[model samples]
Structures are given as structure tokens and as C-alpha cells.
Target: MTTQQDIPGRTVYIVSDGTGITAEALARSVLSQFNLTFSRIHIPFVDTLDKVRQAKDQIQAEREKTGQLPIVFSTLVIPELVTELRKADALHLDVIQTFVEPLRAELGISPKEEIGLSHQNMESLEYKKRIEAINFTLEHDDGQSNRNLEDADVILVGVSRSGKTPTSLYLAMQYGLKVANYPLIPEDFERGHMPKALQPYKNKLFGLTIQPERLAEVRNERRPNSRYAALDNCRYEISEAEGMMNLENIRYLSSTSKSIEEIATAILSNLRSY
Candidate 1:
């Protein structure tokens, strides 16, 4: 019955012998289940016994200062370092050991105790795919080129400042999706049709619209007091773009109250449906 109100804050130490990205990600994913606030301290590159000792000292000092056993989530592959860390006065959670031991037993093989092995393989085909997808997304951004719409895994269409650019980049970099994005301008509305380049590849198109107030606010920050950033203009563009999307039967979502991650995830879910 540990309600959020009972704990004002809890300290979490993310200790890793490498970049610490994996440890931090694991800690955050677990912490998100609870509603309590957390103060995170990342201790990366804890590769040596001296470094582990230093990390142990820091964890002990924090526990003494806060009068609470700080939660330590570590991805230390070195047995000696893990042993030293376990002696510290804290709730030590071994991220690698927990999973690796089970895997070793199940597979009957000793796991390689190497650091950064997952990401260190830069010459990997998966890594190359990500790089190529990123490059394709950059080249096709904002309808910059019409030659490769067919090559895009997904194409995002939105009015000005509705988060078309960032979402496309995220899809490309994270999912290895060759994403292209196009802006829906006033001229396109006046023409009363979809862009000729996008007509054939309509299935790949995803529409994004935002609330007028939010769009206006975003535009105003970039170009203040102009007609382009006006509330009326934003409202008009959103309405027209949404109407066109509906008429064309394209899948669309509002980015008004969504973060980039939420928006990207929803887009991916929509893609899977097709």
C-alpha cells in the first residue's frame, strides 16, 4: 500500500560499464509503472574496479544523505564489479545478471560478457538500413523531391508546424522506415486536389492535424505577428486539410495534445493495420 503521497521522491542510480543508455532505459521503463517522482543519477563507463568502488561510495553517500536506500540499477558484466556494487547499502538490481543467467541456463551456453556488443557492430546490415532510411527521410523532407515517393515506407502530410518533420525523422531513425513528409499549403487547397506526386502513393500517406491555437502558437514562435502565423490562417489550413483527407479516405490523426513519441507510435500502429 505504498501510495504516491507516502513517498515524496526516490533516488535511482543507473550504473553501466558502457554508455549507460540501456540501464537508464530499463530504469525508466520500470519506474514509469509507479506514480512516485524519481531523481536519476547516471554513472556511465563504470568499467574498472576503481570506478565500481567510486560508484559504490557515491551510492552509499547518497543513501546516508537521504536516509533511504537508493535503488541502483546496474548493467555491469564484470563479476568483480557487480560483487563490489552488491556490498553497497542500497537496493541493487542487476539488469544483465537477471536475464543473462536465465538465458544461459535455458540455452546451455555461456553468454559473452562483452560491453557495447549490441551497438558496436557498426558494419551490420541493420545499422546500414537505419542510416539509409535516415538519409532517404532527410532527402525527401517537406516534399523536397518527387522522384522517390514510391520508395517511402510512409509519407506524412500536415499543414505548417503540425509536427510533420520530427515524426518522419523518428520513424526513419528508430524503425528504419523510409519516411517522407509533405506540407499542405494554401495553394494545394486552392487547386482542390492532392499533389500529383502523392496521388499514386495514397496508401502510404498519413495525415496529421493540430489544434488551431497550438498551431498558431508554434508558428508565432517562428514568425511572429505575420499572416502565416495568424490564428485564423491556422484554423483555415487545418479545416481544409482535414476535409481533403476525409474526402480522399486517408488515415489522419490530431497531433494537438500528443507528444512526438505518442504520435509516432500511433502512426506505426496505423501502418500495421494496412
Candidate 2:
């Protein structure tokens, strides 16, 4: 129960023997429960003694500067590297060994202390599926091409900048789901239907909408002082889009406050329920 008041100069160090993606993700998930802001430093590829020592030195420096122990989240696979990292004057969270040792004991087998194994299986069928899904999603993004619309696992419909593209890509990359997204413009609303390209894939459609104010802010960054970025227009488009989705019986979610991960997970859960 680390509180905001208890943490002075909150800094977090994510150290890993390979890419620090896992460590950083775990750290963020854990830190999210706390009410504190933290400056995150990622020290990746700490596979050797020298690299470990350097990471430790950085952690130590942060602790000295802040007068508070910097929280470290480490996924070092090698025992020696983990040992070295422990020398730093910081709270060390061994992200890997915590689960590894338990699993090793339960299975009664020695763990292969490998580095970057999680992402090294590029030749696996799952990896190939992810690659194909990514390519398919990219090709079908923003209603660009509908050559194989039936092949998509999900079709996203929303007003522009409602978080369609990134959500599509995340579904593809993370779950190997081939996703296609289309923007619901004024023409589609005037026509009183979804885009013709997406009509046949009605069951696959998932809609995303954003709050008018947020949509205006997002659009303004791209096209400042334009009617396209106006709050009134945003409200109109969102209203039309929601109406169309409801008319078509398509499921929809608001992306105004949800992260891309949360939106994708919700979409996947909806898809699974079908």
C-alpha cells in the first residue's frame, strides 16, 4: 500500500536481460493501483556482468539523488546478473524468478535460464499468424481495401479519430485477429447505412465512439481551426455513427476513457461471446 505521500521523487527502473517490455508492462500494471506519479527508466539488454553493474549504478545514482529508494522491476534470467542487480540500493522485484522458482519446484525440473526466449519464437505458427494478421489489418485499415473482407475476424466502424487504426493493429498483433476498420463519415450517414464494403460483414462489425470534446481536441492536433475539428461536427458525427450502429444491431464501445488495450480486450470478449 505505497501511498503518494510516502514516495518522494518517485522513480521506477525497469531492468531486463533482453527487451524490457515485459518488465515495464508488469511494473505499470502494479503501479497503476498506487496513487503516485513515477519517472520510468528502462535499462534493457543487461545480459552481462558489466551491463548489470551499469544498471545497478544507474539505480544507485537515482536513489542518491532522490533520497528515496527507486523501485526496480527486473526480469534478469541469469542468476549472476540478478545477484549483481541486488547490490543496488533499491527495492528489487525479480519479475521472472518469482514465478520461475515456484514453477520449477512444482514441475521438479531445472529452468533453462534463457534470455529473450519469450519473443524469440519467430518461427512458430502463432508468430506467423500474428504476422499475417498484422499485414491483413494494415491492408484493410480505414476501409482502404476490401479485397478479402470476409477473412477479417472483426470489422471496426467509427467516426474519424475514434481510435480505430491503433485498436485494429493491437488486436492483430496481440491476439492474431485480422481486423478491418472504417471511418463513418457524413456520406455514410447521409446514405443511412454503413459503408457498402462493410455491409456483408455485419456480424464482424464493432463500433468505437469518443466524447465530443476529446474528439475535437484530437482532431485539432491534425487540422487546427478547420470545421472537421469543430466540436459541433464531432458531436454530429458521433451521434450519427451511434445511430447507425444501433440500427444495424452492431455492438459498440466508447474509446473516450479506455486505453487501446482495454478497448481491444473488450472487443475480443465480445467476439468470443458470439
Candidate 3:
């Protein structure tokens, strides 16, 4: 029964032969399941023997300082480097080899054991599409412009602070979706319709709403005590926005309890359903 109280301040190291992004992401995802607080250290580009020795020294130092075995998540592709790293007195988890060895056995093939292949393809078509989608999403953010509204893969409509911008950007960057987002202002609600720019893209329209309380809290941080951040105003805007979406037969979801990844996945799922 390792409780949160048992580990006062554990050190977790992400060691990689490349940028260390993958190792860190994998480590964080696993660590989130535990309630204990951790001090994370990322040591990247351990491509040389000297760097590997340095990383091993750092891990050993942390273990000595904390009086606890440090946890190391490593994605080092070089065998010699991994062997050297293992000499450190820490719980070492090879992030890549764990899966790679099993897959190799099943497929009867050897791995290239290359470093940084995850992000090596810059001129790839998928990469170019993501870049273009990001540019399109930025250009069309918050009803700024509708120059190519019809080109958007999905157009998000919602009241302010309803998790539109981040979701849009994530959709674009991760899935190569051209996303356009527009705020549902009081004028649109009064006019009993969506924005003029969004009128033609009815098929691509998706809506996000949040609990009035949460919306107010998010807004209050940006503009304290203003009408825009008032709970009552949030309730009014959300009510009107939901009503308009219903009237227009547009699909909508609540962003109150969803992460950006979840929201984007849901949006993509709904889009694919059509």
C-alpha cells in the first residue's frame, strides 16, 4: 500500500537519445495515475558515451540526495548507452525496447535502432498538412476571418471560454484538420442565428458549451468582475447558444468535463460519422 504520504518528493528522470519528448510524455501519462508528487528531470541527447556517463551520474546523485531510488524512463536506442545507464542505482524502464523487443520477436525483424525517427520526417505530406491546418486554424480563430470558411474541415461555434481555441488547434496539429472557431456573441443570439461568416458552412458546424459556473470562472481570470465574466451572463450566453444550435440542427457537445484531446477526438469521431 504505497500511499502518497510515503513518497515525499521522488525524482523521475526522462532520458532520451533524442529530444526526450516521447519519454517524458510516456512517463507523465503513467505518473498521473499516482497521487504522489514528483520532481521531473529531462536529460536529452544522450547520444555519446560521455553524455550517457553524465546522465548516469545525475541519476545517481538524485538517488543519493533524495534517499530514494529514482525512476528513469529511457528511450535510448544505442545498446552501449542503455547498458551504461543501467549501471545507475535506479528503477530503469526502457520506454522503447519494452515494446520493440516483443514486436521484433513476433514479426521476426530487427529494429533500425535509430534515434529521433519520431520527428525526423519534416518534408512528409502529413507534416505539411498539419502545418497548413495550423496556419488555417490560426487565420480563422475567434471569428477573425472567414476568407476560406468552406475549406475548413470543421467549424466550431461556442460562447467564450468554452474550450474552442485549444481544441481547434489540437485538431489541426494532431489530425490535420482545418478548424475555424467563432464566438457566439450577444448579437448573434439577439439575431437568433449563428454568425454570418458561419452561415454557409452548416454541414461543418460543431458547438461547444460549458457549465455556466465553469465558464464564469474561466472568464473571471481574464476580466475580473466584468459582465462578460458574470455567471448570469454565462448562463444567458450558453442557453442562447445551445438553443441556436438546436434550432439550426447543428451537433454540439459540452466542454465542461472534457480534455482538449477528448474534445478533438469527439469532434473527429462525429465528423467521420458523416
Candidate 4:
């Protein structure tokens, strides 16, 4: 059995240790288990012996300053590398990687069994290709196939800089939805109405707009130094486009400065509420 003693104030170096994001997430989760407050240093991508030694030297310097030996926990550790790190002379240290050896004794599961379980989980995933195909058809069918937009789980319409592609992609990927996105062109804006293509699907259609400055920034990243990316042009186009959406009493979301996860989750929440 491994025992961890309480230290009032200690620092920990949570090395990615080749486990990448998964290791960092684990470290964040375990932070509440200890009574003591500590600083967490994330050392990412520790792949070799040289990297391990460098990490030890860094911890060595920190320990010397703090007068408390740092607790080093890593997702990757080998016996030979462990021997090298211990010689660095840090104090009151706990190396948690060595505790993994008890997994076979406690879990009573083999590596092959674990692998098989993962494979089985993946295999059970339902066929989603049909859903994707339906979505793609809506976006690219060019009005030739005459697919019914009313049947879509969600419909998206906005001027070009709006959050259509990403939001539609998220809905399709996450909820197995048939999604369609249509760009409101200048003519549609001038007409002060929903695009004819979207008129029939008015009930399912959604709009995404952005602050002109934010819209310009997003466009500039894709096409720098062009009229499409110019701030004033973005402002004019966005105002006209939004005015058109409003003329029809269409509802919209402001997508500027929101993360993909936030947008997707918000869209899902709205759909669920309806």
C-alpha cells in the first residue's frame, strides 16, 4: 500500500510524461485530494531520458528555493529514469508513477481485455454516415435535388461571416443531426427578407450574427488585406444583413468571441427547450 503524508504547503510538478492532455486533466482532478495548497507546473511531452533529467534539474532548483522537496507525479516513468531522478537530491518527494504496478493485482484485468473493451465500445456506435450525407446534401445540393428543409433537425442562415459552418458541423457531429446552412447574399439583404431558399424552413431556421469588429477580425484571419477582411466593409455588410433578418422577425444569436463548445452547447440547449 502506498501512503501520502500531509504537507501544509508543497509544490508539485505534474509532468505530461507522454500522456499529454489526459495527464494534465488527471492532475487537475487530484488536486482536491490533498489538504495542502500547492502550485502545479505542467511539463508537457516528456518522451525521453534526457527530458526526464532536465525536468529533475528544474524541480531541483525550485526545491532549493522553497526549502521543501517538490512532489513529482508523472504519467510516464521507467525504472532506469527513476534511478537518475532520485540522485537530484530533492526533499520529501513522492513519485506516484511507481504505484501503477499494483493495477494488475487489484483490477484482475489483462491489457488484452482492456483493449477489447475499448474496441467493443467503438463498434457499438450507430451508423451516422446517412445523417452526414443528409447534411451535406442540404449544404451543397444547389436546389437541384429538392430535399425538404422542414425535415432538418436544425437550419442555419446568416451572412457569410456568421457562425454557420462551425455550428452546423458541431450539431451534425454531436447530435447526429441533418443540418443546413445558407448564406444570405447582398441581394437577399437588399430585399429585406429571408432568402427564398430559407422562407419555407422559417420555423427551423436560425441566424448567427457578430459584432462588426469581431466579424472583421474573423474574416481577416482567413483572407488578410482584402476587401472581404476590411473592417468598414464588414460593418456595412453585417448591419445590412442583420437588418434584413430583423425585417422578417427572424431570431439570431451573436456568435462573436464565443468558443465552439459554448456555441454548440447553447444551440443544443435552445433546441431542447423548444
Candidate 5:
């Protein structure tokens, strides 16, 4: 029943003994639903007593400045470390203990609380799959190597810097997908068709396009004062690329205001349909 007017400015801290990615992601996912201004900070590698004390001191300072309790989201697996962080004057959300205790009771066994074990299991089969996917993604970047296009789970096509590379890498690393990306250039545009190399894997193809102004801005950072980065050229490429995608019945998405995570999820959802 909390309304936007009921929300107030606050501070949020994501504390963890490892990379802090889990704690931060949980905090953002929960906080994104509320309309409030949050000053966020991440305290990572707090695996010792000294680091815990330092983090507690920071929380105290922020509470004094704001005249209210700050909100803390933590994923510390060590009992002693979690105990120390709980002493801070804030609304502490123990992200791990919240579910770990129930699961431990259900299984009637003490949980082996290890830090970063979720991602550090390099010897596991899942880890090997992710590594292989990353290697395949790198080898086929930007249409450099098409010898293995048939092995790709998905092939991304778009004009240069339309988020093809990062999206492809994210798809590979996060989903264990073999992703290959190709950049559509003026030569392809002149031909008025999709790349001939991609015709064989038409079902695996997904296209990305961006606003011409935004595309030009991104390209200008790499090659300033050149025709390749000119706004008119960007506009022309986007127009032709989108037109070709539609005419060829290839699915496409716009990357103008969407995050890589959102774009990748959409691509995966589409892939499921086929």
C-alpha cells in the first residue's frame, strides 16, 4: 500500500565477502519497484573482522547524516561476519540466511556456506560449457570467422556498434549459448540484402538496430570526424539494415533504450518459439 509520496530519500548498501554481485543484484531487483532516490554503495571483500568493522562504521556515518536508518542488503555466508554486520543501525536484509535456514531445516543438514562457490566452480560441467561458449563467441565476432556459423545457437546481425558484440557475449556467458555476430556495412547495404553467409542459418539470425543519432554518437567515440561516424551515414545504414531485415522476414529488436540483459532475454524468448 506504499505510495510514491510515502517514499523518502535513503541510502542502500550491498555488503558481501566476495564480488558482491549477488547482493547488489538482489538489492536492485527489490528497490526498482519503489519510487525513491537511493544513494547506493557496495562494500565488497568484507571477509574479515577488520573489514566488517569498517563497513559497520560507514553505515553508522550514513545513518547519522540521514537522521534515519539506512537499508543494507547482504549475502555474507560466514556466521561471524553476518553477526557483525547485523549490529549496524540499519534495516539489514540477510539475503543468504533468509532462505538458507529454511532449506537447512528442510534437509536436516547444516548448509556448507561457501563464498563465491556459485561461480567459482570452474571444474564443473556447467562451467566448462560456459567457457566453451565464450571461446566460440570470441572466434566468430564481427563476421571475422564464419567457418563455424552452423555451430552457433544464435547469430546476431546489425550495423556496427548496435550492441551486437556485448549482447552476443552475454548470451554466451549467461546462457551457455554459442553466439556469433556480424556487422552490416555499406557494402552489404549496397547489395540490398542480408549477408550471403547468413542465408544458410536464417532461422538462427536476430537483428539489432539503434536510433541514428545515438548510433552516430557511439561511432564518433571510436572514429571522430570521419564519414563512418557521420550522422547521415548512420541514418542511412539503420534505414537499409531495418528495411532488409523486414523484407527478408528476419526478426529484429531496437537497442536504443534497452539494456543488454533485456535485449538478450528477448532474443532468448524468441529463440524458444523456433
Candidate 6:
């Protein structure tokens, strides 16, 4: 294979027209265009043409070190500022034109158009509401479980210490999924079905399982050197738990060697896909 190397001394400067973080964040996301690490400077909203002129001079100074400099404006909306930036010609520059430019060009829509908030955004808000409702139920379960479970977006079950609580909280706090979890005790494992309490909500339920060694390590954190934290106990619990899930024909995800964020996202995405 022929290997090619990169050019040296190449750079791109992204100067923001305003101090708003949103504008800076968007510009940061687009920095991959440079094919090199970039430098950023955020100029704040101002009232005077002299200040706008000065910002252009700063852009020119940054441009002197780079092959190209792209200036970004965020609701700066000042015509005088725009005029000054357009006239500065040391290097080729680009401004994010507007949200509607792509829409009009791609879909033949007019300049005064609105796309509304994306469906993902609306779904996110609903997900947050559901998670909040679920958290309230978990904190208050006090033998009064699942009065609000009917309202849960998802329910997770696994043996005790299999990361049930943290995983459920992570799902709620991050993806906004209302998650309730009930543990499967040994007696229930012997009978090989989910907790009768969960049977009523079977369709909404999901399961998590982990390797015995990992489960032992995790339980040790909460109870140092106790029999509950012993590897033998962990192995028995995990094997019985997996057997119970298999006998009941309940599909489950392995939580071993995965971070909480990864597990929660995979679970939510899997549920949505299903």
C-alpha cells in the first residue's frame, strides 16, 4: 500500500461573531473541515462600528498564520459588522449563512420558513418527563410498587446486585426513560418466572445480566469481604439468574465490562428498534 503523509504548517482559525455558547459549539463541531487542529476566538456582541472593525482586524491577524480562516456569526445580525467582515480579504472566509439556506436550496422552500423543533428533541422532552415519573416511584416503592409502573416507559429486572439500581437511574437521568427495576430472589429463581408483580407488565419489561466475577467485584464495593461478596455466591446467583431468564424465554443484555452510559443507550435503542 502507498502511504501518504500530511502537510505541515497548515491551520484554520474560527472566530465567533458573538459570545453565545451555542454559536461557538456549532463552529467547534465543524472544525473537522480544516483537516488540522484549529484555534478559536469568541468576540462578544457590541454596539459600535469601531468595535466591529477591530474584530475584523483580529480575524486578519489570525488569518496571517493560516491558509484559510472561517468567521462565524451568531445572531450578530448587524449589517455594519457583516459589511466589515466581507471586505476583509487576507484569506478565504465563510459564515454559516442561516438555518433556512439549506432548506430553501434542498427543498425549494422560501426564506421565511420554519422546520420546528426536531422529532428527536420533542421525544427527548417526553422521555425526560417519563424518567422523572419513574424516579419518584423507585424512591417511594415502599411495598407500594408500580402504582405508577403502568406509566413507566420501561421496566428492568435482574438478580440483586446485578447493577439494577444504578442502571435504572442512569436510563432515567440520561435518556429520560422512566425505568423501574425489581430483583429476582432465589425462591423466584427456583420457580423460573419473573416476579408475579412484574408479570402484569411483562411486555414493558427488559433484563440485565453480568458475569459472576464482575458481579462479585461490584458487590464487594458495597459490602467488603462479606459472604454476599464472595465469588462462589456470585457464581451461583448469576448461573441461576441466567437459567431463570432462559427458562422464562426473556431476552436480556449482558452488562459485564460495559459502562452505565453504554448499557443504558443500548437498552433504549434496542427497545425502540423492537
Q: Is candidate 2 or candidate 4 better by lDDT?
A: 2
Which residue segments of model 1 deviate by more than 4 Å? 1-10, 32-37, 101-110
In candidate 1, what residue range of length 10 has the lowest lDDT sum? 1-10
Model 2 vs truth, CA RMSD? 3.1
Poorest 10 consecutive residues by lDDT, candidate 4: 111-120
Model 1: per-residue Cα lDDT at residue 7: 63
TM-score winner between candidates 1 and 2 = 1
Total clashing pairs for each candidate: 0, 0, 0, 0, 0, 0
TM-score of each: 0.87, 0.86, 0.91, 0.55, 0.80, 0.59
Cα RMSD (Å) per model? 2.9, 3.1, 2.3, 8.9, 4.0, 6.9
Q: Tens digit of lDDT per residue, candidate 4, span 158-262?
A: 778688877777777656677777777767766767767777777776778889888888888999988988899888888887887787777778888897767
Report the alpha-carbon TM-score of model 1 versus the true structure.
0.87
True-structure lDDT of candidate 4: 0.67
lDDT of 2: 0.91
Regions of model 5 farther than 4 Å from truth: 1-11, 31-41, 47-68, 78-80, 101-115
Q: What's the lDDT for residue 40 in model 1?
A: 94
Q: Give the Cα lDDT of each candidate.
A: 0.90, 0.91, 0.91, 0.67, 0.91, 0.65
- Please, what are the lDDT tens digits per residue for candidate 5 over residues 58-104? 99898788677889999889898888988888999999999999999
Query: Which model scores highest in TM-score?
Result: 3
Model 6 segments beyond 4 Å from truth?
1-101, 110-137, 140-144, 190-192
- As for candidate 6, its clashing pairs are none
* TM-score, model 4 to reference: 0.55
TM-score rank, highest first? 3, 1, 2, 5, 6, 4
| Candidate 1 residue pairs that clash | none
Whole-model lDDT, model 5:
0.91
